[model samples]
Target: MDKILLNGMAFYGYHGLFEEEKKLGQRFSVDAELKFSLKKPGKSDDMNDSIDYGDAYELVKEVMEGKPVNLLEALAETISERLFQSYSILEACRIRITKPDPPIPGHYRSVAAEIFRERNE
Candidate 1:
């Protein structure tokens, strides 16, 4: 399968396990790999035959910055669902979300979650 990759998308979101995290929000970085056939677009070079990633980025931003979810897992799941719902041509998707500073008192760069989903054939 071919891919359209959206990487290092940053957002400030109120998604976490703690009330403080939810109220104050934090910096979240996201990466998405959309799996689909590029055959038509590759052949015809038509916008109609391909998924516009700029639109995809906006979709991600909406989900990430919208409602507050308890976990990154849920956030990823929501994004995957929304992607498939909005774009019929999306065959599958992989989403990775990273929290730059989690609740735990650890000296780490970030905590993250990844999820992959495929359209039912």
Candidate 2:
């Protein structure tokens, strides 16, 4: 399997379980791994032969920049679902959403939710 990585994606989003979080908004980071066989694309050496990663970036942006959600888990699901739905060549994928500087008291770098999915057997 081969991978196309969209890493360290940052956006300002109003997504959280708290009112202040939704109102004030916070930073979000996303990392995704798109897994598939690169043979066809590599052999063809054509952009269209492979998945359009720019489209994938746009897809992630649409989800992250769209509506506010109470949990990163849901956000991850949305991204994963859309990826599988939008791209037929993808055999599996991993989506990780991170919330930096969450409202928690303890000092921490960030909180994240990760989801991995493959085509149903």
Candidate 3:
């Protein structure tokens, strides 16, 4: 299958377990891989035959910037659900939600959650 990749999409959101995190908010990065057959688009060179990545970015923006979820898992789930609902040709997807910084007493690059979902599921 062919794939459409969206990467390094950043947003500021108030989503965390701690009150400070919820109040101050932080930066988030999302990387998504949308899997589907691109044969039609590849051959016809028609926009209609392919998924619009701009629209996909908007959907991710809505979820990442809309509600305040306490867990990255929840955000990933919501994104997966929305993608499936929005694209009929999408066969599977992988979503990764990354927090560049958190209110934790540690030295690390970042924390992230990744999920893979198929249309049948």
Candidate 4:
């Protein structure tokens, strides 16, 4: 399958288990790989023949900043569902959500989760 990748998208949002974390908000990074058949688009070089990366980015950004979810898992799931719904040409997708410098007892650079989904064949 052909793929399009969006990486290192940053968003500032309130999402955490702690009240302080929710109030303060933090930075989150997202990466997505959208899978689809690209033959038609490749041949035609038409925007209508394939998914628009700009539109996808905006959709993801809207979902990320639109709601205040306590868990990254929920945010990731929401993104995945939105992507699937927004583009009928998308056959499969992998979404990664990352939190840099999470609040913990010890110092840590980041934590992330990857979620994968595919349209029913």
lDDT of 2 by residue, 1-121 (tens): 7989999988888899999989989899999999999999999999787788789999999999889999999999999899989988899999999988889899989989998989673
Q: How close is candidate 3 to the true structure, as a TM-score?
A: 0.97
Identify the superior model by lDDT, candidate 3 or candidate 4. Answer: 3
Give the distance in Å from residue 70's predicted Cα in candidate 1 to where it truly belongs. Answer: 0.7
RMSD of each: 1.1, 1.0, 0.7, 1.2
RMSD of 4: 1.2
lDDT of 1 by residue, 73-93 (tens): 999998999999988999999
Best by TM-score: 3
Q: What lDDT tens digits, residue by residue, belong to model 4 across residues 43-92?
A: 99999999999999998899778768878889888998999899999999
Task: Flag regions of model 4 displaced more than 4 Å.
Answer: none
Top candidate, metric lDDT = 3
Total backbone clashes of model 2? 0
* Candidate 3 lDDT by residue in tens digits, 1-121: 6899999999999999999888999999999999999899999999888889899999999999998999999999999999999999999999999998667999869999999999997
TM-score per model over all chains: 0.95, 0.96, 0.97, 0.95
TM-score, prediction 4 = 0.95
Residue 36 miss distance in model 3 (angstroms): 0.3
**What's the C-alpha lDDT at position 85 in model 4?**
92
